[model samples]
Target: MAADITPLIHRVRRWPRRVVITIAVVAVTLLAVRIALPYVVRNQVNHRLQSIPGYTGHVADIGIALWRGAYALEGVEIYKVSGEVRTPFVRARTIDFSVAWRDLFHGKIVSDILVEEGQLTFVAGATEAESQTDVDRRWQEVIEDLFPLEITHLEVNHGLLRYQDTTKTPAVDLFVTNLRLAATGLRNRPSESGEEFPAEIVLEGDSLGGGQLRLAISAEPLAAQPHFHLSAKLENVNLPELNESLKAYANVDVSRGKMELAAEMAGKDGGFQGYVKPFFEEVDFNNVSDENKSVLTRIWENVVQGLAWLVKNKARDQVGTRIPFQGRFGDPQVGLWTTIVNLFRHGFVRAFNPTIEGTVDPDNVLPTGDSADGEGVASEKPETPPKVATDDVKKVEPEAAAPTDQPSKKRTP
Candidate 1:
């Protein structure tokens, strides 16, 4: 019995050495993975980016945070391979994708993405090869591969959005700078109170020539069709700075003035209701001078300036009109006659107010009705006559406006 016990004790005494070796091996393996994970992720990202059709991209570096389950991409750039544009289509200084721990605690796994100093540029030319819209490719698939988790929140800080048209006479380049955007509740996690629109998005930016742009939206992003309420405003834009684009597109130029624009829209069940109001303040149309322009072009510019002067609201120093619209998601009816009437009304009867009307509401929007092309127009009712409402143009608070059951002659501008 003593001999058998001694043999068992010898084996038991060596167990610590075996355990220590096992632990050391695991520690070394984990250390190697930690050191190599970023390199592996960076290569994967670069590979996915290159797979985008007609686009090429590179990732400068990648960083990983093991504890938080986060990774950051630095100095990311994407270019359109076929375009003549020199600027990169997409440039991001840093993009961070992290696990949303708060949602994880609630038994919902999701991700939050932060994009810093990002720039998105769209170029247009005469040929298809010169266009860089990213619409032709499966860019979304690449984005999904980069972040496998469902995205519930997104933020963009100090970003830029640009549109360039090389085919224009003087070439067109317009940009929005210092753009900040935040969106939350995109996954539509169930709420205790059961909110209809579970997500909220806000965007604020500075347009070229010192104009401020703001947009806010409350939406059910996962709905089968479009369902949302939106409001937007672009104000105090120095019109002269927009001459390049205006001349190229509208064949008109502004020598002096500022502009203010506001719009409110609501959509549900594939139907939408909205209005776009544009107010020009102290505008002076530039004299058409280029000898290459057709005589009709110069005549049209003169007519537009004359009409603007005639409809100018003396009291407000503004020329403005409201263009209301409503219909299906893609096709909408514009109130051309109504818009013309509003111009005269603004000048003679009542000066148009440069604030969101707080009129459009999701609850008031009607579901889309079956109609064929050139059929009966939209069924939305006339907007309640304009009055000086709140001056909260930066952000609009959704209001429950009275729903109209009767068909309206109003159309969108």
Candidate 2:
């Protein structure tokens, strides 16, 4: 019995108590790290943004889902570091990111970034002296440097964008809303497929007056410098609604009318070349005569309207012009300012008879309100592509067919 008791004591002493204690401590430390990681990441992001030359902002909140290798941030505001206090150049309500599972495990991270709701306002500096110091690259560089990993995919929804030019005689606030975009193969290097266009992107949105707009783009981002091609089309814009937004910028009412605008552009390195074509099925310049108006203002409005009538193309019921643009993408207005000044300086000369550079089928243009065939759509938004008939079967004796059409030889062969 004494010998058996000694054996039992030895068995009790064999348990590894030290190892168990060590493992418990490690587990507790890991839990603490998991809880604090989001704060640390958010702080790092804020610090990095502040380092940019002319931009400063902070992230309101950040969260991480370690199991999925996903992270999200909310209420990010980036603005100019200035005393004048301008609207935030870029503001995002929420940004979500999800990484590929394999990449997550390999430590070579890449993510599909989603901007749930955001607004980017491009503000013209108060004076030419200030433009030099402002962050003017539209965040192309900042975005590339933001993440440790390359951005492989991108998506956006209901984003808003605006161009505000306070330097003009009357300030202009042009807006685009409900912007949606989808893109793939957006990495800094060649994509896994090694295609010429590393990224293919599609964009759609609404203009200030319910105009439908769409764009297609292909790009080679991994090259020594960025190279890309872009095409855009816009149609069925609401006319009167434009005046409400433009009222502050001009004295008289202006409308886009039954018009369409299309543009094609290409860029490499820092240079961009493009052409914008505007077509008008109809246009009207009206004088806003109200009891509140003074006599001189009414006279001026009428005079401008008259001038528009004289120069406008009236015979074909369509007016159009092709405008060529070239300059650095970073300096979007390099040549644009002169063009804008010329637009007003020689208002009727170009508008009256715009050079017709291209043509479009009016019937194919989607109707914004009602279909002639009585199709009911809740909204004019393009939900699905129009269907195409694919039946290739040949009718032996079609209703209008004569004796013998040439289809018999091909079918027999």
Candidate 3:
């Protein structure tokens, strides 16, 4: 009986060795795939990018290798050879990324990207000869045919943004810290036939001039296109500093103050439209000079004169007294004639007589025409009518008729 049990035990031991060998083979195969996949993918991606039309100076770094999967190229840089270069997306130098294991098997590539410290520069007024339409068209083609990757997680530790008017300089800089974004369901479709996907993004930043920003954006997939909504709030920002940023872009300057803003936007046909109203506290205007004031005064005077009669009548009826209205002062040449007209019309000053009060009427009270004596009355008077004759005496006894209080006594004498 003992001898029979020993043979059985040996056979059972052999089964374990067979199981180990199978596992070893599978492990080797997986390891080889993990090492080889990144190089293969990098080469394919680079080759495809180089083949695209009008694409030059675009490069991708070597892919990272790992046990589970490969952590691929740190970043990809694309630039134009002749025109101004603008980078839409940039990866931070401190970022590390990992490839997805399932993506390799399913033929869908995915990346887990992390950003440590980064900065993005935006230049305004730097227009390229190529229209945005051309760029967009090329981008669509690139996404549809060349590159297809789903980004699972995008983590940013610290990021900075600097904006400048390319036509002007001394760019305004903005900084954001501890930024993070996660994305899913990224797919590409042709512009002619549209497809939609879901996405959500959140951001936080501390602006250079002294403010904080909190932002959130979301979108839902639709049949034809995806619709997006965004909400953002900025707190405790100095407006003068912000205005300096806008000086190169617009003609207005903002004085010292604080401001707040909030808004939402939706996307359509590869573009977006939205409305935003900013609220300011204690803002003042800059660049208001005497010359500018004069121009403004002329404008105001023109506007006021149009409604002057109405305003004057209303004021007289309500207050029973004349109100003094004047225009702003600046260059007097432009508005001199209008000012004189208004002054004479409103009896603001007496042009004819130095000592006369402005209240005196220019037509009647002043010495002019028949009223030269300044009496304001006509000088002529009409004469009285002559006495009428009495009726002729029809008979010898007929006599003239006279009032009792008249010359009766005188006639008898």
The best candidate by lDDT is 1
List the candidates ranked by TM-score, beginning with the highest.
1, 2, 3
Model 3 lDDT, residue 51, Cα: 60
Top TM-score: which candidate number?
1
Compute each candidate's TM-score over C-alphas.
0.80, 0.68, 0.48
Ranking by lDDT: 1, 2, 3
RMSD of each: 10.3, 16.6, 35.6
lDDT of 3: 0.43
How far in Å is the alpha carbon of 144 misplaced in model 1? 2.6
lDDT, candidate 3, at 20? 71
Off by over 4 Å in 3: 1-45, 48-60, 86-91, 94-111, 115-121, 129-137, 140-149, 160-163, 168-178, 185-197, 221-223, 250-255, 267-273, 284-413
lDDT of 1 at 48: 89
* Per-candidate count of clashing residue pairs (backbone under 3 Å): 5, 1, 0
Instruction: In angstroms, give how far residue 395 of model 1 lies from its true place.
Output: 8.4
In model 1, the runs with Cα more than 4 Å from the true position are 1-15, 82-86, 135-137, 188-193, 286-300, 367-413
Model 3, TM vs. native? 0.48
lDDT by residue (tens digit), candidate 3, 339-359: 345334433332211110112
Could you tell which candidate, 2 or 3, scores higher by lDDT?
Answer: 2
lDDT for 84 in candidate 1 is 68
